[model samples]
Target: MSHSIAPATISSPKDLIAYKVDNAEPVEFTSSKGYEERRIHSEIYKRHPHIHAVVHSHSEAVVPYAISVAPLRACYHMAGFLGADGAAVFDIAKHRDPAQGADMLVRNEQTGAALAKTFDNSNRVTLMRGHGFTVVADSIEVAVMWAIYTQKNAAIQTTAATLQSTYGGTGSDMPLSYLSSEESSVAREMTKRTVERPWQLWVREVESCGLYVNTA
Candidate 1:
């Protein structure tokens, strides 16, 4: 994680090695929340007062299309919410000079602010070009589901594009089967009901596996 973000700028995220999940407090360290994670989360929380959680992920599946001209379409049945919310891309390459070699890192306050604008309008999803994506939701559970669905959509879109090209399709000729707005609404509501089960499972995993339990 430090390779992608400068540690000096981040207010020290309770040493990764020391963080445990047994519901015990830190013995010597003055542990705090994820500094940099809080940085972005703060912006989203402030911008959308109703939003309760923000999820950022560096999904490899979304990377290829982020850096390419091909768009991540609503290609999967389970990813219907993506189409309903409207997906968008945020290219730091376009936001900054090419010679600077942005390296897919939001290096400072200015960059972070620029990235936040990626959620310009109605989109709860935004693709960080050459980086990853950020998902905003009313709950952490929904945000988690959004991250998974985004990657799944990206993978499905990639496959769909590949199949179209292999069959001699060109440019706008690519095949697509996006759900209608009405269909997406129903699907989104149905999907929301299913998030509780997985979220509970994740909570169990966190306690059972000690996944960041040092500050518990």
Candidate 2:
């Protein structure tokens, strides 16, 4: 199906911000930085019209794993959402700028595009070490689901590590190929449900709260 955002009635950034706060995660925007977020949102929307929402968050496990030299693997079924190979990690250490906030830790537009390109032929999911994550979906519900499931996978891995250390059990050994199949199925279902039905609800909420301004 062709993925595209319909012409929305909401205009001002405040309305968008309000909508985002009420429906999804609470977004922080000072008057000074608020315009910047709005601009970014607009740019993202313009570039990826099909993307209904863009989520920026810090997944605890993913953060440490990114900083470590070893690559982070998907240890649980839920992590399949990141694809069977697991999400590719882009080394953003060179892109770091202390002046920018947590998000800027990934550095400039080049870094962002590089990270996005990692998922070029796939669905939404990318990790930035010490920065956070960026998940793009056709709707907020799908985006939120990806965020939650990824965290669940991380938590499971953490628990598995504990068990392996204490009880001498083997850690998660699921291969990427197996995980990829599961991830595709879950992503399909989420896309259908979130995009077909609840997306309207999300749009309305974001419009009302003005948080939609952060569309980039």
Candidate 3:
């Protein structure tokens, strides 16, 4: 079948393939195929020309904020891309047809468009309620960084909030301090440029495992 590709089996550049954004038809003949998440990926690239890469991940630590009202703000400088207000929540239930029950998946064009719409001018991350989160960036490296640090921020935030509620004063009263808008802007610009450092480290680690090889 041409509708499935396993990441672990991929060894080099030839394992990768391209597809059209409009209909997701393969650009070249290959046994590999795109995943179901490609629906939102395609819609995002189609709607936002500036976004060169999109990463969707189900970081368990971040799922609490996605399903709750508590925002996932930047707990540290590295996650400044989350901004002061943090990631916007994209509820699949809002876009699902009444007849079709909520399965919490971007199953079609409507759900995909709804997900893409959540990425406003300031939104780099959108957390899908009861599902995973998506991060967008002008480059793949930056997107990977954002995805990694966003989950890290979530873990930190969750831990802090738990400790504060248990030991400190009221959790609501002692709200965790987050980066300001100005601070976030400055940190985002500064950290995005440093993505290559971590990218190289990650590439070396992956290559060491013998599961992947850099062809470039």
Residue pairs in candidate 3 whose N, alpha carbon or C atoms collide under 3 angstroms: none
- Candidate 1, which ten residues in sequence have the lowest lDDT sum? 17-26
- List model 2 lDDT by residue over 173-211, tens digit each: 632223455665675565545543545675677767743
Report the poorest 10 consecutive residues by lDDT, candidate 3.
1-10
Candidate 1 lDDT, 70-115, residue by residue in tens: 6665665667667643578887766665555556776444456676
- Top candidate on TM-score is 3
Q: Which 10-residue window in model 2 sums to the lowest lDDT?
A: 1-10
List the global CA lDDT of all models: 0.65, 0.54, 0.84
Between 1 and 2, whose TM-score is larger?
1
The residue ranges of model 1 lying beyond 4 angstroms of the native Cα positions read 1-38, 84-86, 94-101, 171-174, 203-216
The list of candidate 2 runs beyond 4 A from truth reads: 1-32, 35-48, 69-78, 95-108, 169-216
Clashes in each model (backbone N, CA, C under 3 Å)? Answer: 3, 20, 0
State which candidate, 1 or 2, has the greater lDDT. 1
| Model 2 Cα shift for residue 146 (angstroms) | 0.9
